[model samples]
Target: MSTPNDNPVPTVRVLPETLHRAAAEVFGGAYLIGPVTDQMWERSLPMYRASLVQGIVEDDGVVGGVARSWEVELDVPGGRVPAAAVSSVGVRADRRRRGYLRALMQAQLQTTRDNGALVAVLRATEASIYSRFGYGVASTYATLKVTRRRAVLRPGAAAERRLKMITPEAAVRELPAVYERIRTARPGTVSRPSWWWAGMVDRHLHKDRPVWVLCTVDDDDQVDGFLLYTVNNRDGWDDPQQAVVEVLDLRAVDERVELALWQAAFGIDLSEHLLAHGRPLDPVLDLALVDPRAAVTTDVEDETWLRLLDVPAALSARSYGAGEPVVIGVDDQLMPDNSGRYRVSTDGVQRTDAEAELHCEVGELAAVYLGGTSFTQLAAAGRVRGSSEVLARADALFGTPRLPWSGTYY
Candidate 1:
């Protein structure tokens, strides 16, 4: 395609998988097929086939920039929100000065809105890059490491727990129920699709690496919890036997089931240390192990980036933590009215009246929505403009003592 400037806003058309691979390579080596193997292709193929909106800014038939969006169902404060995950964002080094990324984001966000999505998300390669595009940090995940010698198992009058070594096929049949039961009670958790569950069992557990699963059941023979993990033998290292609990998908409602699940993991004598990724802060692991202090907690960085497509509806979906009335002005570059002032009550009811106290842009609101970054922090960074008192009042309105965390990636 040719244009007046000769740069021709380049025909942004979707390419085949082969061309997509070539484009991914030209864009960068990190996004190659290594992380995405053929086995896992089924999991994401729908994103490419049904959900993907990919394009390239071509310069005389040569690729200059690339952008793609993965439509996803996200768990928000209100409920399951239709959303899109804008990922694999890349621009040719030569195309940096041009507005490629901005153009791509605008097109994708608009497309997502048109498709009835309420939000958009991504794990930003650089934190500062996405905010200007109206994306905000909405959630975080963590990886915690604890030494087997130090994990303090809180001894309480729980029940006698048993660990059963299960096959990947067995795990596939057993785990979803436990996970489904757990997410229903949890506020920030999202429902895992059947594809995700299938991937976990078939590819992860039954692969060449030979991952194992431990099922935890109480004396009544009820399956309440399970741990999907791998054990590594690190010879000559400070901690030799390392058990990395990649996904401790436990759903124990009672102390017995909880303790039994931990016992199942703790009973694995092959590893001297235990580490977990995507675990909630208040993990049942806190009750397992010898001296819990040995567990190293590094804030794992992953967030659900949010852009409010519908301001009033999104604002009214979830109730606030407290009952203080504050006026919030949302700066929405995409949706103008979302920028106006509205009174947010502690009970979760919102109104556009004369009494609105805290106000900021939609991006700032997105950053603070997950509770990882506070309104005060954004104000300090000059991302949100306002007085100290206004920022404080806003913080009081949105800040929660326990930060919101997400365990899944869209």
Candidate 2:
């Protein structure tokens, strides 16, 4: 193990087979999972080989830390822009708090910038760790639980759409196009590369447990939505009647199609309750149900954490609301190049030397970049320093028509 005095610098390189195994071991140890097998490593190696993997090596030539990033196109206000999706971040237990995390993050940001990605996004394992690195909560998700007794669909719900249960193989072949249609129109959604699809398929097709996929088709014989879910037999031998239906993934082209899918999910026979995690905050099921309270939101939490690597590039890529230009000062300690005054309006954005009406850290700005939160709320929390007039102007400039949500997890 490397001591605090050893302080080794992290490097990005083609990991050798031994180091790859060591990295996997460290990751499993950190997460308290079983030992990673050779079979598992070989199966996932192709995906990792395609990503940007970095690690900190000790003087004894053992891997103590690892992080990875993949390229993705994130949907912004006006259009989609290139983004870096970060994942698999971990450090060996023995090597914690020796500045390794800080170094790894700095290197990751610089590498992401070099790849010309405007922003960096991740599903943080801990909410408190990434803010110091200039990342902020950009989107939120809700956990839903609804009793089967109260799952009746409201009158006039879409009944014309045809629903069919399909094999997972069929779903893998047909669902991407349908998902793309919905993802393009939604803010905060990101492109799921082929490797991501493979991983999802592998996860659901585990030998011990299997998942089912259902599709909804329009009259024209085209699929408009898909839902992947699994059923759990809660009561073993005593009461076999109790079961739960858990939704793993769901996507639809429109509300009508979404309602059809939810109707099917709630209609699963013998299931006492329907549970879904990481669903959109504003779900259509809430309005589609006869009793709106049936689909209760048990928890709401941050989904996507965003970091603006290139502030100018990120700010200018998205279109603003119709409002007067606001001169805001952004304090980016990690990236000094981003520390400046920016004039943002519905027209465009430009760096200026003019006095700033509002001042905030880069992370605070990222929190509102997707329009999921408002500047007024941040000001009330002392996150943004400005007057009421400027706060309202900032809020108006960043407001979005729909609540921002990222349904995909990396």
List per-prediction Cα lDDT, in the order shown.
0.63, 0.84
Q: Per-residue lDDT for 1-410 in model 1, tens only? A: 43334544544565667566445544453344344446455555544454354557364656666666655555554456666666667777656645666666767777777777667777676677887877777767677776655554667634576667788777777677767765533334555655556655555444554667776665777666667776554342444554344444555665466666665555555567666776666555554545656666777665666677666766666556554566776778776766787776666645576744556788878777645677788878888776778777667666665556666644
Tell how far residue 308 is off in model 1, in angstroms.
2.6
Q: What C-alpha lDDT, on a 0 to 100 scale, does residue 121 get in candidate 1?
A: 71
Backbone clash count, each prediction separately: 17, 0
**TM-score for model 2?**
0.94
Q: Candidate 1 at residue 383, lDDT?
A: 81
Q: In candidate 2, what are the lDDT values of residues 377-397, reduced to their tens digit?
A: 999999999999998998999
Candidate 1 Cα outliers beyond 4 Å, as residue runs: 1-47, 57-73, 91-97, 157-162, 172-174, 184-187, 199-207, 218-222, 233-260, 281-290, 299-302, 349-356, 385-393
lDDT of 1 at 373: 75
Candidate 1: worst 10 consecutive residues by lDDT? 26-35
